[model samples]
Target: MKQNPTPAPIKINGSNIDLGEALPRKIQDELAHVAETYFGHLNHATVGFTRDGNWYCCTINVQVSNLKVIIAESSATDCHKAFDQSLAKVGRQLLRRKQRVADSRRVQMSAAALA
Candidate 1:
């Protein structure tokens, strides 16, 4: 059976609103819960929040076990929207990473089987 490792503490950087001011108990709890859901799937990650003009920007840099490094950035009028977009981007990255690993293993196995 595979055991999922505990998720590390989340660090947030925000513009306009201070970290405490921007996230209330409910919001902070929700963020932590969602982050933990991904747990061992992501080795390490950094999330940052900023704003420009009328847009809120969120950027996440993550390293998955099989994928060296992946970056996802999105802009929205709200922080939650930005997070949603960024998560979507990361999901795509995960799929690509998994596919690449599968392909590589297939090639290696084929070579070994032939030998």
Candidate 2:
């Protein structure tokens, strides 16, 4: 049986709206899923929601390691939409980071072989 590790605690902050039950749970699950999918481990995460005029803003901060932090923010008319957009951005950022690390290792190995 594959043991499932406990997800890292997520801190949520919002302004001018009741977060309600479903939204928080959804956010927690989605964020944890995304973090695990990209980074394999999540150190910590913080999600913030704010309203600016008609737009709802969502900001997600994910710490995959002690020194590395990824932040993505988006605004939409609905909170859910904002969260989705921000989450997409975070996914892209994490993918890029993972690719960069892979590329660097490949380059080092190739150079070593050449020498």
Candidate 1 lDDT by residue in tens digits, 30-115: 44444444434545566788989888898877665555777889999877788778877877766776777779999999999999
Measured against the true structure, the TM-scores of the candidates, in listed sequence, are 0.75, 0.89
What candidate 2 gets wrong by more than 4 Å, as runs, is: 1-4
What local distance difference test score does each model get?
0.67, 0.88
lDDT of 1: 0.67
lDDT of 1 at 39: 36
> Which candidate has the top score in lDDT?
2
After TM-score superposition, what is the CA distance of residue 91 in candidate 1 from its true location, in Å?
0.5
Clashing pairs in 1: none
Compared with the true structure, what per-residue lDDT tens digits does model 2 show for residues 55-96? 999999999855388999999999899999999999999889
